[model samples]
Target: MQFIGPDLKGASPMNPTYIEQLFVKYAKINTRSDPARSATPTTPGQTELAQLIATDLKTLGMSDVQLNPANGYVTARLPSNTARKVSAIGFIAHLDTADFNAENIQPIVHPNYDGQDIRLPGATISVAQFPIFKTLKGQRLITSDGTTLLGVDDKAGIAEIMGAMQYLLAHPEIQHGDVAIGFGPDEEIGKGAKQFDAEQFHTAFAYTLDNGRPGDIEFETFNAAQATITIDGTAVHPGNAYHTLVNAIGIAQQLLNHFPENDVPEQSQNHEGFFLINQISGTVAHAEIDVIIRDFDDAKFEQRKQWLIETIATMNQQLDQPRIQYTLHDQYHNIGTAIATIPEIRELPLKVYRDMGLTPNIVPFRGGTDGNFITQKGIPTPNLFNGGGNYHGPYEFITVEEMVTAAEVVARMIIAHGA
Candidate 1:
């Protein structure tokens, strides 16, 4: 099981070092996505990582290796050695980290971790705060040095997919159909697979390695939409301000006050939906409020959008002018609606997990993933775990053994498909 890499002297695909090295190397690269930018990747660091992954894919003897700068997607293909006409399978992970502190990430590896409080420079992962650490006892855990995020949200996923591919390449006797790999950028900002060429991806179906914990297989996600409300105001001299002047900033605050504070991200969990005002900025002359709405049920999602429109109309009527201009558009729909027709896509992972002696935990993904967009484009893509905990922040951590297990599960899926 511990076969050394031909190029990476001491690295073995089965050994946790192989995936840990890749994770540590990738986590150091600051690929944090910016939502304010309108470009495909929204940042240059993503392109840098994409290029690095492309070179690594070629080094792994993968074919059709391509790094599309226009979209910031790095993809490659591993041809099948079997004669059976099995449909090609795809595995996807994002290149960019979340919008947290991603600069100067110092990944610290704790080998043979005992159940103890891990102290970082600015943050601490206390056993009391995260009881799950007790379960990960005796495993090698990787975390940030506390000045920045660990970037294991999707970097772990990338390393797991790469490890699985390397394992199959080293063991040619394990039969599998064509395996396609895609590393997308800006998934943190929900634009990772927006420009993904599914036809060119050449896969009948896919799975996004972008969730938390092992044995998690999620197909249900929130129906999402984004709304931008622009408020215009009249500016006048102080002498005439009493009757002629209007403050857009004040109106923006008033509009926000109308939204129920209890119906926000912090107050809602599980299947409950919420309307969150993520960003708001402006002066007296012009103001803008950027909000996001999420709900799992189609009826509730539509009602939320309708409520926003009605709130804007009510504000305009009170102001006696069209000062508040707004636009609400669908970002992505729930993937469960599309995947419901294809039972095999969901059942495959369950069967794989059972065969691997792992309990399959079918949970509703509280947020969205690349699978949401790709599944809408004719692929029944679900989400698998990246074997991490406390994602998207400084307290994020993952065990080397968990990542190795993820790679083994991925390899098992491919082998099962070829059967």
Candidate 2:
């Protein structure tokens, strides 16, 4: 794959041109993190890209360039010049894209979009499918040609942090405390922060530039868990299988029937929780089931997991084989509890954005973030938007205007936190 040259001729750290260049730079790289691999980064592309970012930080005069050998985690330090000592703050972003396809991501620049349906070179992006396009008139936007994912879920975040750092280095007169930068791999597979060196890359608080839409400041995310079930049966000749043979497929269907139809992903929204049956495979002799459970409330999430366990026992008795085995695994939790204790960290960014004439939209994340894990690890971390929508799919997009605003917002947050 050829690298697309980012045109940064007219771009500044706080303008659409500069942010667009950064997005273009990050988007052109194919760094998909793999879930099945045992290696730290999981993908070779992620390690390559982490080195690229580390080089950039060194060129920008950031000190303490340390790249982790285990997971390809990258970290840098920017010392503060403020007279009064302030708490060190961290800004984090992921280096890898989703496990989706990333062959040739052709990004289309809508230079001053009229808020209508946009037709890419191919049928990759369309306004009719994404109604949110109506709200972005007169704003320059970037979209993939629909062949691959845009990678804005966290790449846009990486750009925001980089652009803000460039701005701060250019203007050192700005009073601020120490700033820490971290980029991790395998976030898409829920393992990005597993090998993160929190003690080495120390900071009092942190914020993940990984979310959807602009003005979105999130401190709460869904509690997540995965469940797997296996069923066994005996196969017999069809001619004599009337009563002796047990169809494991039928038993799998019985488990699905046990779940409430209304509690699925398609029908639920807001605080409504769901039990999603993601994968299934079965035959007369063997069968396997995989399910994902999500909810904002801890009690509801636990209940959802318990329901799956009870369903397996009930089905085993109905089949009279008792050959069903189940396994449950927890993924992550909501950061609301962590943020509630450190109200200053939650309110600081919102106050900074509002002071800049921007309306801070407080939203609950229906998904988990690296911040969820960092918060529980003793760092006050929250999730912030990078001005992108419809992530992890070919329809993903990022507004040039929103990316620039995000840079400004981040710079402002650092300044306020130092004070």
Candidate 3:
């Protein structure tokens, strides 16, 4: 298959024209993942996008292009042109978008955006709400049509990586080592990198282009786990429901109320951890709730999980029956511990950014990425920015210039490795 789109044969590395075009093209594809689906890639759209990316890589003269439908990972290699045998580096981005309305995404382009409230059909990108918009003045901003997410969470990462690879291929005079690219699916559902073949990827270290905001380099992420609480109750007639009938919904609500309301996602920021009861469903006879526990610190993470266990125990004791049943499973751990051992992984990107006159902002990410699992697999992968804001929602936005800068950073990293 051939890459189908505009001709980017001799495009400059600094030019964001093709990057912007690719962002719009890829964002239009519906690649939203389904957490309920217990399948690799989770949805058909992810496979479709992975195949399309494989075609694009091949068209860009990438070698050894392979698209694995089983894992929905599209991988390709750009063989080093430099004489020195430099260690290979890999760049990865997920294909699937977050669980949001991602169908028929209409990307609205605001050229030379002024700092103000930009109104959409049912939403508004207000400078007051997101003060970051003020810094984006005089830049072209791309957003969704207020009905769907912009899909820029990692698609912008994909475009930036593709743009960097295309730039390297176009300008063969730029010396670089072997560059491997991997685009995986089901990342939004936390299963994208579970089956990632580090042996096949063949890189000393990799970077997940899945973070947001310019100048952001993330190595620390939340240690995460999921808990499901179920309650069983006896149902009886409303008229005869004096002491015989027990409402499971009320018990579920009581369990939720026990959690510290102040320590939730909405009120927490920076390094603070939170317990989020994201989903609830119940009736008079039965009820269930899904909660996720997250923290950056290891001990704190364990305490958060212990709190949930104790809360469940207390609820069960209060009911005088084992009515509340729960299952807690570890999802991913913080990558900071691994990255600390190898300072080069973090220092390399910092050097590249500093050399490019960009201030590198090392942030502790509140959420987990594919890097969390990939790092646990012995490949110390960190995260780089894709240059977007308000991700996973309708107000999401990114600028072509920011994406271009991100691409340049990727290219610089390759060059630094080669030298």
Candidate 4:
């Protein structure tokens, strides 16, 4: 019952080394997306990663491998090898890394971990900062050398999907329905799934391999939105007088004070909503403050949005003129609403973990994923684990063995559904 690869008897085992090699190759690529850019892929490296994945899928005996230039999405299909009629499903992953220093990424390998502080060139992966290192004491861990992010937030996911497809193709003995694969760009910047075509993916449901460990299933994510407040100040000579000049920076500070001090990312936990100030910049003439709002409950999410609108109105009343302007846009919503239509999709992973004799770690995802937006597009997509830890930072790490487990879970999920 230790389903290391395909759950079926006599099924071929997943190549852990193969998955590791692919991960290392993809990780070395600097696919960091730029939020400053409005382009679809955001960066050139993301389009490059998408192209590479399309070629890999084609070489792995996949059909209909198409790379859409408009949005940087690489989608393919593994035609059904069985006669049974079943719905097609998919596995998706993003190609870009988070916003961090991603140049010259050197993935260091600790073949034998000793449970000590890992000193690198720019930083240290210590047990104190990340106590989870103790649980992964002796595993073969891969990490960045402190100068850059390891890109494991999603590249590990790409490798797992590739490894799973390679295994299914090499064997051919396992009967299954059509299996779809999607690799998109700029997910780190929260813009990847915006242009995804659910009809083109042609899947009844899909799983996005994001940042998490094996045996973990995430069906719920935060209802997310972005808010920006722009203040226009009447810049006058400081010597001329304080009464005529309105300091925009001072108004920005006053606006920030209106936000709940306790309701922030660092203070919030499971199911707790937060208001994160993503960016704030400007001079006395003009200033802007960007915030991100997230909540699990729809009512609370709406209320949070209403609070921002009301706060802006009340603060503008005190001013001589209405110089404060704002813009509010939804980023994504919780996947719970979409998946509720297909309750079985959420339960399948639990059964897969039980059948594999692994404990199920079902929890509410504190952040949003590509699945949140993809689900809103009609397909019930939930998040699967990529077997990595401490994502989006220098201390990020993942074990090769866990990568194999992630690949195995992909294969098992496919068979459990359509085989």
User: Lowest summed-lDDT stretch of 10 residues in model 1?
Assistant: 1-10
The parts of candidate 2 lying over 4 Å away from their true place are: 1-17, 114-117, 317-321
Residues forming the 10-long window of minimal summed lDDT in candidate 2: 1-10
lDDT of the candidates, in the order given: 0.88, 0.81, 0.88, 0.87
Q: What is the lDDT of candidate 4?
A: 0.87
Model 3 clash pairs are none
- Clash count (model 2, backbone only): 1
74-109: candidate 4 lDDT, tens digit per residue: 999888888899889899999999988999999998
Q: How far is 130's C-alpha from truth in model 4 (Å)?
A: 3.2
Q: What does candidate 2's lDDT look like per residue over 378-409, in tens digits?
A: 88788888888888888888887788778877
TM-score of 4: 0.90
Error of 4 at 144 (Å): 3.2
Comparing 1 and 4 on TM-score, the stronger one? 4
lDDT of 3 at 283: 94
* Residue ranges of candidate 1 with Cα displaced over 4 Å: 1-13, 36-42, 121-123, 234-254, 281-286
Question: Candidate 3 on 212-328: residue-level lDDT in tens?
Answer: 777899989999999998999999999999989999999998988899979999999999999998899999999999999999999999998998899888888888588999999
- Ranking by TM-score, best first? 4, 2, 1, 3
lDDT of 1 at 140: 91
The best candidate in terms of TM-score: 4
